[model samples]
Target: MGRIVAKVTVANPVDKSKSRTFDALVDTGASMLTLPTNWKKDLGDLAETRIAKVEFADQNIREIEICGPVSIQIEGFQKIFSEVAFLEMNTSDGMYEPLIGYIPLEQSGILVDMLGHRLKAAKYLDLK
Candidate 1:
């Protein structure tokens, strides 16, 4: 499967004014919304940070900073409450690639439509 991308808005729950929208990658393999480390200050007033160990696709493991209780809104979907995992990541040309993962998508009842190459609203939420 190729890459799937989405437009996402991340905001401070209490202060919606502190929000930033980005062209985020749809990465189901990732556990939560991941943003560039720089975003923490942009989406300010975040809660204290905690550390989590991450294993990359290349099999490299590193500890990263995780923060937030930020609101996530993937275009065409309802907003969902979630945290942001900040990784010092960049593309080959030095561009940051923010990503929205499975947790937020499931929270908003959105399903990946990889066959159609777009996101679709889920028929029903899972409780099982």
Candidate 2:
């Protein structure tokens, strides 16, 4: 199986607020969307507060925060609200931009078609 890369836009849903739109790697392993600390200022007067520890690709664990509610929108799809983390913006290592993780996927009820590189709502499984 191959990987599918998707474009995601993260925005603070407030009047006259600026949003960050970029290409993000859809990582099912991640539980939430991680943003850069630089985005903190853009989040407006909202302060970025630490919440939990996050393990990076280097295997180093760092304190992560639930900065604010984010509006994650994919092309031709509805925007979803998610708790995000504020991390340092570094690209020297090979990691995707603002990793779109499972939390967003589940909240959005979207399943990715790995082979076809598409997004679709999942069908419910009934045990009955």
Query: What lDDT score belongs to each candidate, Candidate 1 first?
Result: 0.87, 0.71
Error of 1 at 74 (Å): 0.6
Worst ten in a row by lDDT for model 1: 89-98
Which residue segments of model 2 deviate by more than 4 Å? Answer: 47-49, 93-96, 124-128
Could you give candidate 2's per-residue lDDT for residues 1-128 as a string of tens digits? 67666777777777337677777777887888777777666656544555788887689998876866667786656678767777777777755377777877777767888878777776752235
Total clashes in model 1, counting residue pairs 3 or more apart in sequence or in different chains: 0
TM-score for each candidate, following the candidate numbering: 0.92, 0.78
Query: What is candidate 1's TM-score against the reference?
Result: 0.92
Checking candidate 1 for backbone clashes, the offending pairs are none
